[model samples]
Target: MVGSENEARITAAEFRGGAGTAAWRVTATGPQAVFRAVSLTQAASLVGPAVEAAERLGILADIDVRPEGVIVCVPDRDFGGISAAAIAFSASVSTAAASLGLEPDPARIQSVGIYVAQHSATDARPFFAAALGYEDLGDGDAVDPLRRGPQLAFNPITGDVPRRGRTHFDVSVPADQAEARVAAALAAGGRLADDSHAPAWWSLASPDNHGVDIAAWSDDVGD
Candidate 1:
């Protein structure tokens, strides 16, 4: 069980350092755990325990149970990021899963978002939010209220040479897995666009020149 020390907001690194969080990974959305199961019914069985765990912490758990597994996320919507309460909830869920003979596969934890390059984010934010039925995060980003769709981030166009692609993907994964994922993408015909931000993020382009950033910074301290 979490105590008063676990009530404050913490960085991804701090969250990961705590006990009972080994099964969870800090994603762009928050701390998430992916638990594999043999059947949909088995996956569904975790929902009640997970939800109850979150409720005990006075937070809500976003759980998606599919045919093969269950994805659980504890996001602090009020704090606009991961809070200690969220972490506590995550740990509780993991504990419950363990008791039920389930364990999280951290490598399967990731979040996908859309990156939109714009000259003036203020001018473009409203349009994208309205078009996608997303909520503007007031931080040059927007997200689906139901968390069913990828987040949308508007980045400023820098320098004289404009970016080749106006829109791209931002795949946030565990820091340790960033290099391997990049290599796999390259092996699958993707070309490196930029790696100056390696370890934090890497830009790659598809065969057709579309961009995708494999980002691991989201789980870092300063992200």
Candidate 2:
């Protein structure tokens, strides 16, 4: 088994540089891949290979199989980021998908997280963590131990009142897809809230004023 100390410091660049990682995108949480499957049965077929690969590497992976496709992720809390073993597991899964004629869709891979506006993150962390059944990661962030839910991050409120809703969603996608995603959201009736961070992230509001931030800064792993 790969020790946590050895796997914890691996970076996005390192993972991308490894063989057969074109299908995966490295987010802040870890490396994720989306495989295109036509049905739930087809998606489930990939789970065995994914789990076997992780087992071979003595690592844990989250596999979510849906009717449309399957999402796989490797998140390590010990290192608080991507791990070296993740690269091997991802490569093995990619090989298995290829053998089964399933193609990986990088554009379809994304991570969703929630942001809460708090007057004092320290004071509010415990309540939210308990409510969500999450483990406080101690940096204004809380995560689902099961890796089945979106992560939550606490952002400081600048004024006595929140300018918008107390909570917003942040979707992180591959850097190349951020522009098109932003455009699509706007076309869908969402209004641009902030773009000063364009190419990195963009803040948008739904017709109902719910906020969403399209981010790509963390997924900029280069070849």
Candidate 3:
């Protein structure tokens, strides 16, 4: 995780219509193996940056644009380093900043956090590690999925709650390890939420009350 001194935090992207948190907001209810990027421009403009970032990360697979947001899908393969999630997050952040006429600091993105209405800060760690194969960095303060990008962090609500945002995790795993991953998730701090992995994915709900999706990439969505 990037230190506080080196980090600049920005939660979800807000739009011109005052549609707050619409930038990186997940639009659905179940565990989904995709990154959500909503905008007024049919999700294409929103995903433009992600395409660039994914290529830079060398995990370029393909993307799907829904009316509400764009789904940055990763193929069921490796690209030397990490892949989708971070690229999607960073790309969305950058796009949002650009839309708002502000500059996004890539070097300062410490971690992407989950907004929990109520929960212990430490509760999210084990589930993320066991479910999504994220490494517990700083015990519970941050988790490193390593495959995608950025660290996953916890964000407990303080005062007024705006919108109940969904915690998104587009986890990538091997076909053989799929069941074990599901087992670990349940045993640690997560419970099975959905079987979106269908032909190849598993979705789990964490103790911190967030959804985690463990999946291999697919190219059939926008093809």
Candidate 4:
């Protein structure tokens, strides 16, 4: 959901991880922040429970939403399949105290995502993506999308890159809470991609070729 549409910005995103239940570092703008979660939650997981509990306060005021695209990254080892992960929601702000079921300070939240892996022939597919946040890049408390930008190209283990250039972010949620997040996005009028719509691994293995495809929320849908 990333492009200049109706004066609104749409951006596609995804995530990656080396192991299960790992602490994920999500870069939003600048000064990257980190979160912990698993990697088994299905791409189609965050569609029910989260939505039932969270609510929208205003237009683009409480969620992260983006367009659909592809994200490619080199793995530590070769595998039979691929899996792409993403967080879907509108470009909005969320209060941890208001949206999440748990009790946290009602601070602004950027539509953030975690990373996923590819193991099976059907793993290299993107579900949806989003980044939730409050202030723009000016505020120190807010994430600087350009500063904490996604790793466009880099080596998996050493994080070494041959050439420095713009690259897509590899962000996805842990498998454990994938469903809950998806449900929240949907309830906010967001949707995740069906596994069936995913493409084959061979179709998207080039290191230089990476992207993330997320569904954006329309005015009516988000409302």
**Pick by lDDT: which candidate is best?**
2
Under the 3 Å rule for N, CA and C atoms, how many clashes does model 2 have?
Answer: 0
C-alpha local distance difference test of each model: 0.80, 0.81, 0.43, 0.24
Instruction: Using TM-score, give the best candidate's number.
Output: 2
Q: How far off is residue 175 in model 2, in Å?
A: 0.8
lDDT agreement of model 2 with the native: 0.81
Model with the higher TM-score, candidate 1 or 2: 2
Q: TM-scores for all candidates?
A: 0.88, 0.89, 0.28, 0.21
Instruction: Put down candidate 2 lDDT per residue, 1-223, tens digits, no spaces.
Output: 4545545556788888889898988865678888898989888999899989988887778888898899888875654556677888889999998887778998887889999887642356688789889998766789898877898888887664534438899998887778889999999999999999887899999999999999984544542
lDDT order, best first, reads: 2, 1, 3, 4
In model 2, which regions exceed 4 Å deviation?
1-3, 6-8, 162-165, 218-223
The runs of at least 3 residues in candidate 1 whose Cα sits more than 4 Å from the true structure, single-residue gaps closed, are 1-7, 76-80, 158-165, 218-223
The stretch of ten residues in a row with the least summed lDDT in candidate 4 is 69-78
Backbone clash tally (model 3): 3
lDDT per residue for candidate 1 within 1-223, as digits (tens), equals 3323455667788888877888888877788889988889889989898878777887667899997899998754543456667767777788888877776788888899998887642346788899999998756788899989998888877552443437899999888777889999999999999999887899999999999999984555644
Error of 1 at 52 (Å): 1.0
Tens digit of per-residue lDDT, candidate 4, span 1-223: 2111332322222222222212222222211112111232321122233232223311111122112211111110111111221111111111221232222111121234223332223211122112432223221122333323322221122343433332233333323333444455456654443434322101111233453322221111111
Clashing pairs in 1: none
